[model samples]
Target chain A: MIGNAGDMNVVVCVKQIPDPANPGSLDANNNLDRSSKLIIDDSDMYGVEMALQLVHAAGSGEVSLVSMAPNGETAGLRTALAMGAEKAVLVSDDTLKGSDALGTAKVLAAAIKRIEGADLILAATESSDGYTGTTPVQVAEILGLPSVTFAKHIEVDGSTVKVQRQTEAGYDEVTCPLPALVTVTAGVVEPRYPSFKGIMAAKGKPLDQVTVADLGIDAAQVGGDGAGQKITNVTAAEARKAGEVVVDEGDAFQKIVAFLDQLKVI
Target chain B: MAKVWVLAESAGGKVSSLSLELLTKARELGDTVEAVAWGADTASIAGDLGAHGASTVHDLGDLGTSLPGVSVAAAIAAAIEAGTGPDILLVGQSYDGRDVAGRLSAKLDKPVLTNVVGLAAGEPPVASHAIFGGATIVEATFTGSAPFIYAVRPKSFAAEPSGGSATVAPLSVPETGATNAATVVDRHVEERSGPQLDEAAVVVSGGRGLGEAANYAMIEELAKLLKGAPGASRAIVDAGWVPYAYQVGQTGKTVKPTLYIAAGISGATQHMVGMKGSKNIIAINKDQEAPILQIADLGIVGDVHKVLPQLIEALKARS
Candidate 1:
């Protein structure tokens, strides 16, 4: 399967997050509340879409998803599954409740390995919630695979992946061999909404649920106690009090200029 | 007292402002502050790092066209294995910084406290991170091991120079194997003028409410009149109205300009986190109840297309 142009198997790492519109709260252990219903993170949709497109471009390949969440939630996976992903591998266990970036990476790396012949692994550069933005690289390290993060565009060539990696100044053309992991930035591609037929087909797709123990990772090393950092205290940030709100009476521009004059910034 | 190591980044032979900010904070938290840098121009930044509080500069020299992430991380991991690591490693949340921190974390099996906005000197070095779009602050400490890694946010501290010089030291990058295979074959820089978004004194940003991609010119024109920079909300950037470099949000650049003007932008929390630190915020939007109005110093409820032209004409008249 290596370097074959036609049959590329891609794995997309997806994250299930709480709605960003709603305010989130911390739990008793100082963790962001995950008891609420979770949906697929908006950022991951691009990766899923990119993977599906890559597979389709290869003419004969399938897209699989790997995710970690609480309560064995498949609500998010089902969304990607509906987006034409062939299958999913989910790692869910009570022990993963307070896992940090490294811990989460460990679980994800383990889940990814179970897939027999994934030529490429994909993920968003960071999750909307818990934007540590480090999991993909850590996963690459664990699997000993080359990785390219912040990919704005990706194209698979034979057994290699070429990426337009985003940088501070601009973009860099980067190339890595197959069996590599790439973290895509948002806007890399426009994600497609699941169609009626796709939604119907997703229900029958295979979703294998595994625990930390099943992955041979010690339960003790994948949870709160296993986290490398501990939350000591949490407090509300100093709030910026409300200022004057004015209806534009056709002269609001004067007020803006006046405000700038006051700040002496204009 | 703790020994601190700051990851310094340089471009065109000058160190980044964020690296200086990190070094300033590192000096305050540790007894001895050192810096680590890569690239062919690493030597040129030693004086700047030293003036910012790093007494020693560890130069990894040039790695040809190979990405610095793998080699830099491997070198640091090797340093730790050789029992020469610092008590705390402060990394600016730059692109390369994240990659090195992540790979090193995996190699050392350590955890990194990322998005750190504040730090305190302590046994384990407590780091404060802003969550919920800067609504809450969480103070955390590493549970195990020294050389606690922290990926700090930009503009969290001021960069103050002490007028000192650094002693340059050569550090070696161990063999990182296939993980280092990703190579940079070409580089492209999108030509941009005016002050940088993160460093500008005055910033004018547009959102989806700007209506079309062409409308962003108003933002640029206004910013230019104010001698500042033009920025964008993630909505516009993601929608292809502007490049990602112009984006201002949690995932984008955090800008704490003296004056931040939001035109036709209903603030999202993600976008708020990036610009909430501005000294003065003025938002103009038709939706009076837009979240951005809540924190803006002056909130003008109006259509951007109308307000922008009038504001631009008024500013032009003043000049």
Candidate 2:
């Protein structure tokens, strides 16, 4: 369901990732424990902010959100709704748990197709927790749409959207037509804090919930059973030993250089 | 003998160091190693790629100065369709590299393993990724068909020249109509006086302990005196004290310098994942028990505001 005959209709992908500040525990399957309190990934805020700005700039458009979480947890989705998204589409099902990047992308692409008249899809380059960094492009590929990644700046003109894509050495100015997907980098824009009025208004926002059966997605195509890549084993990294410490007693710089000399790094 | 292909990135006719690193690693995993490049003449870098164990170099010719994501990936997909695809395709973790890998995965309906740090020799190959901020290493393997694509992190592997030359070849690819639709209008490179944060041998980073945005100048000055690059923790960057280009963290750029000096940073897991691979780590903060100190090779228990000025002066005097 799309709303408002605005200049553009944008669907922003938001993730409710585990809080990075808190150490996460592993489940019986050795997967991240999703039972903990989840929060909006820091990187996803830029995409939401960018979509809001684009819709506002267009003078008459609506921004909807799409998220896939375990057991239909909407705590993270509600945060995005508070940021002024008109509605949300949450795809949560037991069969979708542990779906790899590709399977997740497939589900998101299906939801976007169901939206009827979406012109653009925006997502963060990667989730703070998963950090697979390929889902947005995978979604684009499944939808047969052109995709741009690591966009630092975006401008919409007529039927085309221009982006300043970040590069190793610099940035490249790339323009693609509407019906494209873009994944934005963090700090691309200053995200606005949800106001009291906006937060209160979010309670009434429409959040459409769907299941794998509703989307007609095969259970075998998602979750651990269908993942193309399997984490065969995981091991703890060797702990770094407590090294030498020096009180900065006026001659501390010399000690630092001496240590650097030992390592031949300076 | 598995066939391996690396997406070589180039600028001004020189191949990227990360591509060379991939080629070096590819040599050990496959019997045949090839490289594919776009937008620039491949002849200039063919010899360079060969030295890294590439047996053949494929050139896509010039596709204009636009972003190479669409054109390069389309060319590779066409090659795959023509029965010239490799068993494994490796690309750097850079922006354009990921764009190409993503589009190629889409075109081929293959899943791409990204942020790979290590690889093990196998029939299909296994990739290792550092997760939860480098606290754990998880190994994954592809279960599907050929052409297992991976976007590898920079500095994960060492690039060594084998001193061998390769045969250069021109690959003809069918025109993909969507390649040219996305055109480049302008380009801007941030003007920095010193080494890039990712490539710098020494990176001196500042965090919120710098107190105010203006105090960042001291970090820059110290980095300059040490002949290194200036970096920022997520706190400072998020506070608008520095541009995102200088941010060193999981959400930012992953850097593996010879020496990484963290000043006043609390050593959050996100930031640690980016620099934990550095050859050496040194932390300078007043809090002796900060998380960063746990990983630092040398922890200086002192105030950065007081210690940084003196260190800068000492470095200047020595230089």
lDDT of 1 at A171: 95
Each model's C-alpha lDDT?
Answer: 0.91, 0.84
Q: Which residue pairs in model 2 clash with each other?
A: none
Which residue window of length 10 is worst by lDDT in model 1 chain B? Answer: B38-47
Q: Which numbered prediction scores highest in lDDT against the true structure? A: 1
For model 2, residues A17-68, the per-residue Cα lDDT tens digits are 8887888767888778888888888888889999999988988778889998
Error of 2 at A39 (Å): 1.1
DockQ for every prediction shown: 0.86, 0.62
Model 1: residues with Cα > 4 Å off, grouped in runs: A1-5
Clashing residue pairs, candidate 1?
none
Error of 2 at A162 (Å): 2.0
**Model 2 residue B306 lDDT?**
85
Error of 1 at B314 (Å): 1.7
